[model samples]
Target: MATQQSTGSTLTRAWANTALPTLGAILAVALWWLVTVALHIDPFFVPSPADVLDAFMRDPGFMMNETWVTFSRVLIGFGIAVAGGLLIAVLLAASWTVERMTMPLLAAINAVPKVALAPLLLVWMGFGNSPKIVMVVLVSFFPVIVSTMAGLTSTPADLRELGRSLSASWWQTFVKVRLPWALPQIFVGIKVATPLAIIGAVIGEVVSPDHGLGSVIVGSGSSADTPLAFAALVLLAITGVVLFYLIVAIERLLVPWAAAIAS
Candidate 1:
């Protein structure tokens, strides 16, 4: 009975925590609807929620397919960015000289506007997934590299010395001490980069693609289908939120101690 009661209480608290945000979202939408209706705003200029919903419902299949295409690009690009970033970070961490030599160049490259490069990438890679995936990697890679480097290098000198004193091999010491210590910071980078990956994919689609939400948005805009454009925007926002929360959920599962400490 006690265990069941405890579980019930926990669930109650979780729902309570989320309730205010849910209410706020509903209230905001209601306000939007009321204002649009009261002002007799043109749907072409500023679509009401109902208008957007109706537009989305008119052809849900097409919208869903575009959404799926964009989402798949986000996932593939994000996965590659994470893997490549971690590998590069590890290599940088292995030698201060190499880090000093390459980091400035990387920073310079990252500082350039990725959008400006999209057309070039499209030209080089052609109008397929390659350019989109590359854009996602370019946008998402820097944060992971910076965060992972910070985490790996932040291990205490005393701990590293202790490992050396124990005659631990370099690889063994890194595996046993540095890697676990770095996981939390690495996750922070992953979370930060995930949304950027989506943005990058969208940019790629905008520059070069026949399908995907970005293309749909462009087409809707060109046709003055504001409600359809708004609908696509809503889907993009939902996609970003969903991806971000998924990363958070994974972080909680993989690094429970980090999550606990954060709480």
Candidate 2:
């Protein structure tokens, strides 16, 4: 009976935790609906939840297709950014000379506004997925590189010494000790980058006006379909939230120790 009670309590706590966010979301929507209806605000300026839902329901097919396109770009770009950032970080961490030589250049590049570069990317890469993918990589890679390098370099000196004493090879030390230690920080960078990836993809699509949620938003705006545009924005928000939580879920699964430490 005690064990069963404990399990029930645990389940209740988890449910409560999950319900809190849903409650907040419901309250926000309620407030928005109330304010919009009470003030009789024009839907063109700020669409009501019903207006946005109506727009979505009007043509769910097109919305889903565009959403899928944008999502694919985000996924591809984010994956590349993570892989490339990790490789670059490892290289930089391994060599003081490389870190010193390349760090300044990278910092300078990252300092420039990614939006300012979008037009140039469209000009160079033309109207296709290339510019969008490149934009996503550019925006997402910086945080990953920085966080991963920090994690790699911050491994305890004693751990290095212990590995050396054990006659462990560099690869072995990195794989068995340094990498695991760095996982948490690396995940931090990845989580930070995910939202940026979405923004980058959208920025690219907005500049180029190709097929994606961004393009849908742009077309809707030009056509004065504010509700449709708002619907697209809502989809983008949902995408970001879903991707962020997906990353968190992956972190919990792959690096449960890090999740436990964080908790």
Regions more than 4 Å wrong, model 1: 1-8
Give candidate 1's error at residue 143 in angstroms. 0.6
Residue-level error in angstroms, candidate 2, position 54: 0.7
- lDDT string for model 2 (1-263, tens) is 54565577777878887998999999999999999999999999998999999999999999999999999999999999999999999999999999999999999999999999999997898999999999999999999999999999888999989999999998999999998899899999999999999999999999999799999999998899999999999999999999999999998898988745654
lDDT values, one for every candidate: 0.92, 0.94
- Where is model 2 poorest over a 10-residue stretch in terms of lDDT? 1-10
What tens-digit string does per-residue lDDT give for candidate 1 at 93-159? 9999999999999899899999999999978989888999899999999999999999999988999
TM-score of each model, in listed order: 0.93, 0.95
RMSD of each: 3.1, 2.7
Clashing pairs in 2: none
Candidate 2 stretches with Cα past 4 Å from truth are: 1-8
